[model samples]
Target chain A: MSENTTASTSPGVPVEDPTPFGWLTTADHKRTGRLFIISSLAFLIMGVVLDLLVRLDLTSATKFVSLDADSFAQSFALSRETLVLLFLIPAFLGLAMYLVPLQIGASNLAFPRAATASFWIWKISAVVLIGAYLGNGGPYGGWANGVDLHLLALSGLVIALLLGAVTVATTVMTLRSPGLYMDKTPPFTWSALVTASMLVVSLPVLLGQIAILYIDHRYGRVFLLGNYGIWERIDWIHRTPQLFIYVVPVLGVAAEIVLAAAKRRVFEPLAMYFTIGLVGLFGFGAWTNFAITGEGADIIDGLEGVVLVALYAGALIATAGLLGLLGLAVIQNRKLPKISTSLLAAFAAGKLVLTGALVGLVGAAADWLEIAGRGNDGNPQLRMTTWVTGQQSVLIYGAGLLGLLAAIHWWAPKIWGRQLNELLGLLNFLVIGAGALLAFVGPALSGLLTEQPDFVYADPNATSLYSNWVDDTGAEGLSALGVAGTALLLAGAALLILNLFISICLKKGTEATEDPWSAQSPEWLLPSPPPIGETDELPMLTSGTPLLDAQEENEEANT
Target chain B: MSDITPTLASGRPQRPRTQLVATGFASAVCAMMMAGALGFYMARRHASGPHPGSDWLDGLAVPNPQFDYALLTLVASLVTAHWALWASRRRDTAHAWTAIATTIVLGLGFINMVMYSMNRMGLEIGSGEYQNLAFATTGLALAIVVLGLLYIGLMGLRSLGGSVGQRGSTSLGAAVFFWDFAALVWAVTWYTVYVVK
Candidate 1:
C-alpha cells in the first residue's frame, strides 16, 4: 500500500494515440470502449435536452414548446427511448468495453469484431432514430413511413445492444485470468456480466415487440390498435423491476468505488454479488410487455399478477441489500473513506436508487392491486401516472448517470490518461443530484397528488394537454419542480460535457501517476494510459484482489 | 517497491474454442427472439379460439406441399450441417466442401419453398391478426436461415484458410451451432403454424 510505487511517465512507452479513422475500423477493446463512452455521452446531451423540452411541455401541461400533442408525445417517447438505449445502456457498455477486458485480464473481447460491429450499429441506428423522430414518425408520430423508419431504427438499436452484451458476457465467461472464478470477479466486472446476461435474455423480447408493431403498422394497422396500443406493448421495458436492469451497473460502480476509494475491501463480497445479481434478475423484463388482447385490454390473472408483485418486491429487497452492503463498508473501515467526488456520486447514486425502488414498488403494487381486483386506491392512483415515469427517470437518468460518472472520474487516468478537474466533477455531481431529485420525484409525487396520466396527452375539452386534472386542487408546485429538474438535468449534462472536454481534450492535469489512488485491482497494474497488448504477462491469479495480494507479498519481501 | 507490477495481466491461456463459445451466445439470442415472437402467436391464437374456420389462412388455400417441403429441407440440412463440422475436424477437405455446399443448398431450398407457399396462399400481410403473425414469424425464420447460411459460408472460408488439426475447426463448429438453431426454429414454427393447425 506504499504511495511511492508510482510509475513515471516514461518517454519510451507508447501512449494510446490512435488516429480518428483508426477508431472507426479498430477492434481494440480500449478504442471501442472509448467510442461507446463518448458517443453515448453525446447522446446523453441530446437525451437530456429533449427531456427538458418534454418537462416544459408537462410543466405548462400542454404542447407549449414542441408545437402539437403528436410532436410532444413523439419527443417524449423518443427521449425515453434515447435515455435507456442510447444514453444509459451504451454508457455502461462503453465502461464495460474498456474495463471488463482489463479487469478480467483478457487481451480483448471474446469476439472483437462483433464488439466493433455492435458499437457502429448502435451509432448508426441512433442517428437513424433521431432522423425518424424528426421526420414526425415515432410511436405516436403522425407520418406512416417515419413511424416505420423509427421502428426499424429502434429494432436495430436493440440488435446492436444485444450483440454487444453477448460479446461482454462471452468474454467474462471464457476469458478470465486463471483462477479468477466467476464468483470472485471484481464488483464492476461482475456487474457487467450480470447486466450483459440479463440483456441477452431480455432485450430480444423487446425486439419481438417492435417487430410485431412494425409489421402491424407497416402492413395493416387494424389488428395492432393505435399509437397508445403500440406504446403500451413496449411500456414494460421502462416500468419497475424491468427498468431496474439499468441500475444494476450503478450498484456495481458504487461497490467498486467503496473498495478503491475506501482503500479496503468489503466485509462480505458474496452479499454484494447477490445484490448485483438480484437487481439484474429483477431487470429481466421481457415478460413485462403490455401487448395482448390487442389494445388497452390486459389479461393479468392469478399467477401473472402474483409474479408481478414478487418482481417489484424483489427490487425493493435488492436495493435494501445494496444499502446494507454500503453500510458494511462504513463499519469495516478503520477511518472514514476519503470524501472524493466519485464517492460522493456513489452516495448520491445509492440514494437515488433507493428512492426509485421505493416509488417503483408503490406504483407497481398499486397497478398490480388494481389489475388483481384488490384496489386502485392509492390516493390519486399511481399505477398509470407520471409516477411510473418518474421512478424510471430516477434510476436511469439520476442514479445510472451518477454511478457511471463515479466510474469515469475514478478511472479517468486509465481511460483518458488524466484526472478530471475535481472542482468541476463535484459541481457536476451536485447539479445532477439535485436535478434528478426535483425533475423525476416531483412528477412522481404528482401521480399521488394529482390525477395525471403517465405522459403528455391532448384533452378534447380542455385547452391544455391535461384534462380535468389541471383543475385538481393543488398548488402547481410539483409541475414547477418538474420544470426546474429538467433545467438542472440539462445543465448537469452540459457540465459533464465540459468536464470531459477540459479533462480529456485539453489534457488538463499532469499524466496520472500509476496507482495514484493506491487502488488494489489488477487493472491498476498496467501503465496509466495502458499500451497496445496489455501487460507482457501477469502472475497466475488465485484471488479476486490480485493487486492487494501482490502488495502484501512486496511488503513481506521488504521486511 | 518490489517491481510489484507482478499484480495481474489479461489474455487467457490461448483459448481454442472462442468461436464456439461466442456462437452459443448468439444462438441463445436468436432462440429467445423466436420464443418471444411465438409467445405473441400463441396468445393471438388462443384469443381467436382453438378452431378458427378455414378462413384463418386469410381466404387462401392451405399451405400443404410447400410448407411440408420447407420443413423436410430444414430437417435434412441439420445432418449436412453436422457433417460439415465432422468433416472439417478430420481435415477431409472434399467432404467438408460437399457437406457445406449441401447445407447451403438446403437452406436456399427452404427459403424458396417458404416464398412459394406464401405466394400460392397469396397471404396478405395486413389482412388479419393471424396473417400478421404468420408473416412476422415466417420473416423471422427466414432471417435466421439467411444468417446461418452466411455464417456457414464464412466458416467455410476460414476452414479453407486454416488446416483444422486436432483441436478441430472452431469456426466450423460455431457455424453448425447456428445452423442447428435455425432448424430448431423452423421445427417449432412448422409445428405451431402448420402441423398443429
Candidate 2:
C-alpha cells in the first residue's frame, strides 16, 4: 500500500521513485500526456505568432512587413499546418491519451512503449518540420502544395499523426478495465476511438498523396501542370474530410462537459453514439464534395456524379442528426448548475459547431446551385473562397479550441489536483469567444464579396477591368477586425496559461476533492491525480454514471 | 485527512499476449490501409484518362523482372520468419534458430535484388511520373522490410543470449507478424506497379 499525499501541495513531485533519469524513459501515461500538452501548447504559441504576422500583413493592401511572395506563402502555410497538425489535433489526442485510461479505469495505455515512441516521434517530427522552414525559404507550396521541403515536412507530420492514431486507437480498444463495456465507455473515450478510427482510414490517403507529390517533385514536374487535377483531388480529400477528425473528438468533450455540468445522464446515450458514428462515417464519405469543386464538376461524370450526390446526401443527413442530438441533450438536462467557465466554453463550442454546419450547408447549396447553372459564373470560386476558411475556423479553432478548453477546465482537478482561477477562466472564455466570432465572421463577410482571399498579392503594375473586391475598403476593414480578434485571442491564451501556472506550479488554488465538479463519470470516483502504481483498483462500473450510483447507494445505507 | 493507507490497485496489468496481438493487429490494419490507398490512386489514375501505354511503364526505367524476383524473395523471408515464430512457440530452439537465419538471408537477398533492379533501371526519381510512383511504392515497402529484418536480427541475437524463449515468444511473434505484413505490402506494390499494367 502506498501512502496518500495531497498532490496539490506537492505538484510535479513523482509519487513513485523519483529517479533523476525517469523523465527520459517514463512510459507513464500521465507524464506522457503532460509532455504532449506542454509541447503542443508551445507549437500553438508559435502558430499564433505566425497567425498574427499574417493578420498584420493583411491589415493593408501594401505589404505591412514586406515579405517576399515565397516567404509570405511559406509563413501562411506553416501557420495553418502548425495549428492544425501540431497543436489542435495533438492537444486533443494528448488529452485523450491522458484521460481515456482513467475514464475507463485502466492502469496505463495499451502500448506504453508505442505511446512513448509516438510522443517522441511527434516531437521530433515537429522539430524537423520547423527546421525545414529554415531550409529553402520554408515550404512555399501553400498549405497543401507538394513542393520539395514542404512535401518532406508534410510527410513527417503525417507519419507522426499516423503513429498517434495507432497508439490512441490501440489503447482505447485494448486497455479498458474489467466491467467497462464498449457501450458504457465515457463519451470522451468513445470520441477518441472514433477519431482514431477515422484517422486510420483517412490519413493514409494524405500520406499517399504527399508521397506522390514528393516523387513528382523529385523526378520531373509530372504533376506540376498536367496532373494538377489529380493532386487537387487527393489534396481536397485529405484536407476537407479530415476536418471532422479534429472536430469530432472535441464534440465529445463538449458532450462530456455539458453532462457533467448539468449533472444529468445524457438524454439518449445510444442515439448520441449513433449520431457520432454517423459523423465519422459521413466525414470520410463527403470527400467528393471537396473533390468536385471548381472544374472537377465538369470533368468528373457518369458514376462519379452518382457517388457525389450520395455522399452529399449522407453528409447532410449526418449533420442534421448531430444537430438534433445536441438539441435534445440541451433540452433534456434535469437541472442546470451555476454557469462555470467550462460550461460556457462547452456551450460556445456547441454553437460554433452549429455555425460551421450552417455555413457548410450554405457552401453546399452554392455548389449545387452552380452545378445547376442557376448561379453566377464565378460561383465555384466563390464557394472556394475565405468562406471556406471561415467555416474551418468556426469548426477547428472556435469549436475545437473551446471544447478543449472546456475539457482542460473540467479535468484540471484530476490532472493537477487544483483548480484554475475561476475569474481568469471566465475572462479567457469571454475574450476568446469574442475573438473567434470577430475573426471568423469578418472573413466570412469578406468572402461574400470576393472570389478569393485578399491576402494573395498581385503585382502593383498589373491593371484589370475587374474590380479587386478583396483589397477594397470593406475587405480591409474585415482584415483589420481579424487582426484585432487575433490579438484578443492571444491575450486569452496567455491568461489561461498564466492561470494554469499559478494554480499548479504556484499552488495558489484550493485543493481539489475526488469529485471537484460533482461529475458523474467513473474517473471522479478515483483520487485526484490518481495513484501512480500497478495496484490502484477502481470500483467496478455498474452503470454509465458509476460514481453517482455509488454515491446513491452510500446515501441509502446512511438513511 | 484520515491516515488512510492508499491501497493502490493499479488497474489490470496488460498480458504480454494482449500486447503482441494488439500491436500485430494495428500493423496489419495500417499496412492494409496503405495498400488500399495505393490501389485507390491507381484506380483514379486509370479512370482519369487513356492508359499511357506499356511504353510509359517501360520509359519509367523499372526492371520489372528483377522487381518481381525481389518481391518473391520478400515472400520467402516472410514464410521463414513465421516458421521461426511457430518453432519458438513450440520451444523448438534449434529449428527456430535455423529458420530465423534463413529468413535473414532471404531478406538480404530481397534487398540486394531491389538494389540491382534499381541500378539496371538507371533512372533517377525525377525521370517521370510513373518512375515517381514506382519508386515511392517500392521504396516504402523496402524500408518496411529492412526495419522488420533489423528487428528480427536483434531478436535473433537475444535468442543467442538465452534470454528469449517461451516467455519472449510474444516478441518473436510480433516480429514475425510485422515481417509478414511488410511482405504482403511488397506483394501489393509488385502487383500494382509491375504486373497490373
Candidate 3:
C-alpha cells in the first residue's frame, strides 16, 4: 500500500493549530490517551508517596508521623483511594484509549468528545477527593466503604468513576476499524472491553450507594445510621467483583506480550476468548461470596449456600483455565528469542494472578468450613485480615500493576517513539516484585498472627491483641519488612520514570522502527508513535495478526 | 500514489447502528441506576419501622387521583417522544417537530405536577427516611425527564432549522430511547414509592 494513499487526515477536517489551546481542545485519540496516562501517573506518584507514609506509620507501634488514630486511618484510606481509583484503573484506561483505536486501525475513539469529558471529569474528581483530604482529613471510612458513607468528596469521586466507565465502554463498543470484527480484535482491546463492561455493571451500584448516602448526609438519614449490612453490601459490590475487573485487563496485556515474545499466534484463539468470557461471567457471579458470611449473613441469608460455593468455585476455575491456556500457548511456541522485559513482567503477572486465585480458593474453603461449623469462629477474622489483604495485593497490585508495567514497556516505542532501557526495565520489575512480595507477605503473616480483623485494629499502638502480635510475634519485623519493601518499590517506580525521561526527554536513545518487536498486531505496521489521524495507514486485516501475514507476504515475494 | 479511500470514511454506514447500540447501553445503565436507587429506598424502608413520614403514606395507600393523572402525563410524553422519532425517520419533518414539541411540554408538565404533588403532601425530605426516599426517587426521575426534554427540544429546533432530517435521525432516536427509559423508570419508582406499601 502506498503511504500517501493510506495516510489521510482525520475526519471532520484536521485543525491547523498545534499550541496548548489546540491540545486542550483536540479530540485526537493519541493526545487524549497521553493525557489520561500522564495524569494517572501523577496520581500514581501521589498514591505511592501516601503508601510509603502509611508504611512508615506501621513500622513502629507508636505514631510515626505525629498522626492521631483518625489521621492514620485517613492516610491509609487516602492511599488506597488514590491508588485504586485515581491511579491503576485510569492508567489502564488511558492505555486502552490511546492504543485501542490504533490497534483496530480506527482514526479516533468512537466518541471523542465523551472521551475528553470523561478524562476531565475524572481529573476533577481526583482533585476533589484529594482536596477533601486536605480539608477535613478525608473520608476515613476506607476506600471501599468511603463513598457509601456520603461524603462530598467521595461522592464526586464516584461520579467521576461512573462517567469514565461510560465513556470507555462506549468507545470500545462503537469504535473499530471497518473490518475488525469482535473476535478479531486484539487481546488488549478485548480486555478493555471486558473491563469497561465490569465497570458499567459494578460502578453504578456504588454510585447508587453514594447517591443515597449523599442525600442522607445533606438532607436526612435515608439509610439507617451505622447499618453494617448496608455497608457490607456496598463494599462487597465495589470490592469483590472488582478483583476480576482489575486482573482481566492485565491478563489481556500479558497475553499480548507473551504472543509477541514467543513469536507465535495464540494456540487456541477461540478457547482463549471463551475463557475470557467465562471469567467475566464468573467474576460477576462471585460478588455474593464476598458478602455471604460475617456482617452480610443477615442480609444475604436467603441466598442458597450451594450457589455461593458454586460461584466461588466457578470464578477460581475460570481464572485458572485462562492462565493455563496462556501458559500452554507460550510453552508450545519454540520461536522464543531472548526473553524481553515485557515477557518477564507478563510471566510474573500470570504467576501473581494464579497465586491470588489459589489463595482465594483456600480462603473460600476456610469460609465454607466455618459456615459448616467445622472450623474455629476466629477463621472469619483471619480471612478478613491476612487472606483478604493478601489476595488484594496479589491480584490488584501484583498482577494488575505488573501487567500495566509490561504494557508500558511493550508499547513505549509505539507510544512515544522511544525505547525504555532494557536493564532498567528488568531492574524495575525485580525491585517492585520483591517489594510486592514483602509488603504483601508481611501483612498476611501479621494478620494471621493477630486475633482481631484488620480494620478493627485502628491504632497499632493500642494495647490489644493486634498490638501484642505486633510486639511479640515477628510482626514488628514484618512491619519493618513492609517499610523496606515500600522503599524498594518507590525506587523501582523512580527508575522506571528515569528510564522513560532519559529515553524521551534527554533523547538518549535512537528512534524506534515501525515494528521494533516484530509484533503481529496491526499497530506494529505503523511507525512508532503512529501518525495522528492517519490510522488508515494500516492495510485491512484478514486475521488477528495482520502484520505477521504482511511480513509473510513480503518474504514470499522476496523469495 | 494508489487511489485508496480511507476505511474511516467508508465505515460511516456502520456509525448509526453503533450509536444506537451505545444509546441502548446507556439506557441500560440508567435503568440500573434506577434499580439501585429503588433498592436503596426499599432497604431503608424495611430496615426501620414507620417514622413520622409514614403518616403521609395514607395518600399513596388510597391511590390518589393526582398521581394517576401525573402517570398518564408521563406515559403520554413517552408516546409523543417515540412518535417524533418515528416521524423523523420517515422525514415527516412537520409531524416530527410537532410531536417533539408536545413531548417536551408534557415532560415539563410532569415535572411541575411532581413538584405540586410533593408540596400538597407537605412531605419534607428531612421529615423521615421514607420521605427522603420519596424525594430522591422522584427527584432523580424528574431530573432524567428534564434532560430528555432538553435533548428532544434541541432536536426539534434542529428539525425546524432543517439541520436534521431522515439522514440525521439517529440523534433523535437516541433521545427518544432515553425519554422512554426515563418514563419506564418513573413508572417503577411511582409504584415502589407510592403504591407499594
Candidate 4:
C-alpha cells in the first residue's frame, strides 16, 4: 500500500507545462479529459441555441426567422455549423473512449499507440468534414454524407475502437484485483464492457461499408450505385440487421447509468443476456426494414415493415420492464441515506425514465400506424412517429435537447469536479426541459389539426401554431396556458446558458481535490487529481465500493 | 527496492471459450457468405468476358512482379521465427531484436499485398452491389492482417523484457510456420481455381 509503488507521475513531472506548444501537445489523460468535457459543453450550448431559434421560428411561420416553404427546405439543408455538430457527438463519444478508462482506474489504455491514433483520426476527420461544408457540393447528401465521412475518418476510428475495446476488455480481464470478477464490477464499468463489445462487432461493419463508399467517392467506382442500386448492396449482407449496431451500446449505457444513479441493480442478470441477444437479433432485424421499405421510403412502409417493427416493439416492452425497475428505484431513493449530490443524480435519473418511456411510446405508436396503414396524410400516430424520428425538427430539437441536459448534469461532477448550485441546477433543469416539452406540445398539436381552420380567416395573425388548442378552448384559457408555457420555456433556456457560465466561473477550486460523490467506483480510489501514470498500489476492494473501501483501509493503517 | 523484479505479471486470462467460439463461428459464417459472393463476381466476369474490378478489392490486387514477393514474404516470416527461437535459446538480445524487426516487416509487406489486391480490384466505396460486398470482405481481411501486425509488435515489446525468452520465441516460430503453411495452401487454391478452370 506504499504510495511509491508505481503508476505515479515522476515527482519531477509538472502537472501542466509552461510552454504553450507543450501544453497543446500533451496527451495526458487528465488534460485531454478536461478538454473533451469542455468541448462537449460548447457543442451542447451550440446545439441548444440553434434548436431554440428553430423552435421559435416554428412557433410562428412569419416569426423573425421566416419559415416559408422554401425557407423550410433551405433550413433542412446541411450547413457548416450543422455538419460540425453532427460530427462532434461521435468525436466526444470517442473522447469518452479515451477518458473513461483512466477514470475507471487503468493507468494507460490497453493500446496507447492506437489510442493516440484514434484521437488524430477523429480530429483530422472533423477538419475534413468542416472543410467539406464550405465546398460547393454541400458535404455529400443526407445520411450518406455521414457515411462518406465515416469512410475518410474510419482508420482513426478503428484505431480508437481497438484501443478502447482492449482497454475495456483488459480491465475486465486483467486490470481488476482478483476479487472483482464479472459479477462484482461497478455498473459503469459493466456498461463500458458492453459498449466495448458492441464497438468490436458493430463499428467494424459500418466502417467497412463506409471505407467502400470512400473508395467509390475517390475513384469512379460505384459500390452502391448502378444496376444493382445502393439499397440492394446493403441488403445483401445486413438487410435488416444494421439498426442494432448504433442502438445496442446506447441502451447498455442507459441501462447502467439508470441503475447506478437510481441505486438499483438490474432486476435479473439474465435480463441483460436477453437484452444483448435481442439487440443483436433485432439490430439485424431493424436494418432489414430499411431494405424492404427502402431508406427514406414512404412513411406507411416504414411503419409497416413488420419484422423490424415487431422487433422494435419487443425491445420497447423489455425496456419498459427495465424502466419499471428504475421506477422502483425512485421510491427506494426515499429510504436511502441521500447526500445532496447523490440526490441531484437521483432526480436526474427520475427524469430519464419519463423521457425514455415517452420515446418508447412514440416509437410504438409509429409502428402501429404502419401496421394499420394510416400514415402522416391523415393519421395522428403516423404524424407523431415522423416527428419523433431524428428527422423531425420537433423530436430532434426537443427530446435530444432534454436528454443532453440530463446527461450533462449527471456527469458534470466527474467532468469538472464541482457541483452546480442546487437552486440553479433545479432552475436549469426546469427551463431546459420545459422549453423542449412546450415546443413538442405546440408543434405536435399544430400538426394534428391538418387543415387551417375557419378561425384563421377571422384573425390570421392571432391564429398562431397552437390555434387548434386555442379554438378548442373557445379563444381563452388554453391559448393563454400555451403562451405562458412558451414564454417560460424560452426565458428558461436563455437563463440556462447564463447559469452555466456563472457556475463554471464560480466553481470551488478546492473541490477539484475531492472525488465529488464519494464515488463507490475505482475512479475515486485515486487522489482528486489522479497521478499521471495512475495510483501506485492497486486500490483494494472488499465489496463493489473500492473508493469507500480505500477510505476504510487508510483509517485502519493510521489506527 | 531491490532490483525491482517485475511483479509476477498476470497470466493471460481465459476468455469464455463459448463467447470466443460464437464470435469465431459468426465471423466464419459471414466470411463464407462474402466468399460465396466471389462466385457471382466470377460468373458475371465469365459471361460478360470482362468485368470492372470492385473498388474495395482494388487494394488487394498484387502486381504480376509481386508474384515472387509473397514467397519472399513467407521466407522472411520463417527466418524471423527461426531467429526468435535461436535468440531465446542463446539468451541473446541481438537475436530477439532481429526476429522482432523481420517479422514486423514481413507482416507489413503481407498487409500491403492485401491492400494492393483490394485496391486493384477497384472495390471502392459506393461501387454497386457486388463491389460493395467485395469492399466489405476485403476490409475484414485487412483487419485480420492488422491484428497480425499487432501480434508482432506485442512480441517485440515482450522480447525486450526477456519475458519472451526461449518458450515465447518457440511459440512464435510455430505460429510463423502455420502462417506460411496457410499461405501455401492459399497459393495452391488460387492456382487450382484460376489456372485449372
Candidate 4: stretches off by over 4 Å: A1-23, A48-104, A139-173, A221-306, A330-372, A375-385, A388-414, A438-500, A508-519, A522-526, A529-533, A546-559, B1-163, B166-197
Q: Write the per-residue lDDT of candidate 3 for residues A513-540, one digit (tens) a residue.
A: 8778888777776667765543434345
Q: Candidate 3 regions off by >4 Å? A: A1-11, A14-16, A59-66, A140-150, A221-238, A285-309, A369-380, A457-472, A534-538, A553-559, B1-14, B50-63
Q: CAPRI verdict on model 2?
A: acceptable
Q: Could you tell me how far off, in angstroms, the CA of residue B168 lies in candidate 4 after the best superposition?
A: 7.1
CA RMSD of each candidate after superposition: 4.2, 5.0, 4.4, 9.6
Top-down lDDT ranking: 1, 2, 3, 4
Error of 1 at A465 (Å): 1.4
RMSD (Cα, Å) of model 3: 4.4
Candidate 4 C-alpha lDDT tens digits along A166-272? 44454444455545566666544554555455445544443444444455554454433421133223332221124233333334434444545544445565565
Candidate 2 Cα outliers beyond 4 Å, as residue runs: A1-21, A59-68, A141-150, A219-238, A285-333, A370-380, A454-473, A531-539, A542-544, A555-559, B1-17, B24-54, B58-65, B151-167
Candidate 2, A439-515: lDDT as tens digits: 78877776665443533323222232113543344766776777777777778677778888898879886688878
Please identify model 1 stretches exceeding 4 Å from their true place.
A1-17, A61-66, A226-228, A289-301, A367-381, A456-463, A468-471, A532-540, A554-559, B5-12, B48-55, B166-168
Compared with the true structure, what per-residue lDDT tens digits does model 2 show for residues B97-151? 8999999999999989988887787756766556666677777777777878887
Winner by lDDT: 1
| Higher-ranked by TM-score: 2 or 4 | 2
Cα shift from native, residue B70, model 3 (Å)? 1.5
Between prediction 2 and prediction 4, the one with superior DockQ is: 2
- Among the numbered candidates, top TM-score falls to 1
**All candidates: DockQ:** 0.55, 0.34, 0.39, 0.13
Report the C-alpha lDDT of model 3 over B21-122, residue by residue, as the tens digit.
Answer: 666666766666676677767665665645665553534333367778898999998888888878888888788878988998898888888787777767
